[model samples]
Target: MVIDMQKYFLNPVSHAYVESGPAITQKIKALQDCCLGRNIPVVQTRHINTKEGAKRMDRWWGDLITADNPLSQISNDLKCDKATIITKEQYDAFLDTGLEQLLKKQGISQLIITGVLTHLCCESTARSAFMRGFEVFFAVDGTASYNEQFHLAALLNLSHGFAVPVLTSEIIEQLESRT
Candidate 1:
């Protein structure tokens, strides 16, 4: 699953939100293309904030990522037309979303997680997936954040308990090698 790879997170203007966003966007697109070519199911998630819910998040992080904003739209580089797009209101993609049901419908028990804000949405969803009994292959370089330390922290924490940290290339190779 690609979590929060929208312009709001990936654009250079939002560097304060995620410094490595643009580069990570490219890495994620490459991974997405690899998955598409291999016929692997790819789920892309976008964070859409509601005005009412915005207040809560704003209190902590200030107003950002409003719904209907172009920033909230997924990056054009990542073609979600061939992927299942999931809209989320909070950090965890499965919260009140059809993610779990969709996964079940497709008999998908494992997920390769990639996207922006490694410590926030991506980590949240990874933990949630693990708690829900899904095997998580978290891409270390596939996820971006404000800095290398923050990104590594999330990878460390996830590798410790919630997920198995992997590289984008490794995942692409695995998918390509699969029948």
Candidate 2:
């Protein structure tokens, strides 16, 4: 599951929000394109918060996902519907979403992760999945943050503590080496 790669990430001032919009794009089309080629299910968890959540996440609240947030919409090329887009208020994807059940139904043993805010939502979701005994493969290059330190921190932590971290190229190689 990809976590919180919304238009808000383009902003430079929002707390924990990174600059991943048009100027300094993060996601490599190669990885998403690979999934598209294989028909791999790529579920995106977007953060569309209520007014309460917005007030609660104040200062920390990223303006993009709110009702009035201008950047809430996902990128045009990578559009996701309500069904494919799991909306959640919590940091963990499993808190209120049916992500676990979806994986189980599809026999998905592992999750290939990519998106924005590498150290926050990505880290939180990775931890949740790891605790639930799901194998997680974090895509290093496909994910990004405000800076390289935050991005590498998430990768190092997930790779050493929570899950195995793999580069986008590595995933493509593995995917290709198999069928």
Best by lDDT: 1
Candidate 2, 37-145: lDDT as tens digits: 7877778877877766555565564443674676675655467442278888767778768889988898878888777767877888888888888898887767777
Instruction: List TM-score per model, in order.
Output: 0.93, 0.83
* Superposition error at 162 for model 2 (Å): 1.1
Clashing pairs in 1: none
Reference-based lDDT, each prediction: 0.85, 0.72
Candidate 2 colliding pairs = none
Off by over 4 Å in 2: 11-17, 20-28, 53-55, 62-64, 80-83
How far does residue 16 in candidate 2 sit from its true spot (Å)? 7.2
Ten-residue stretch with the least lDDT total in model 2: 20-29
Residue 57 alpha-carbon offset, candidate 2, angstroms = 1.8
Question: Candidate 1: where are CA atoms >4 Å away?
Answer: 15-17
User: lDDT tens string, model 1, 1-179?
Assistant: 98988888767776345767777777788899888887778999988878775547767777757766777888888857789999888899999888999998989999999997898899999999999999999988889888788888998999999999998999888877886
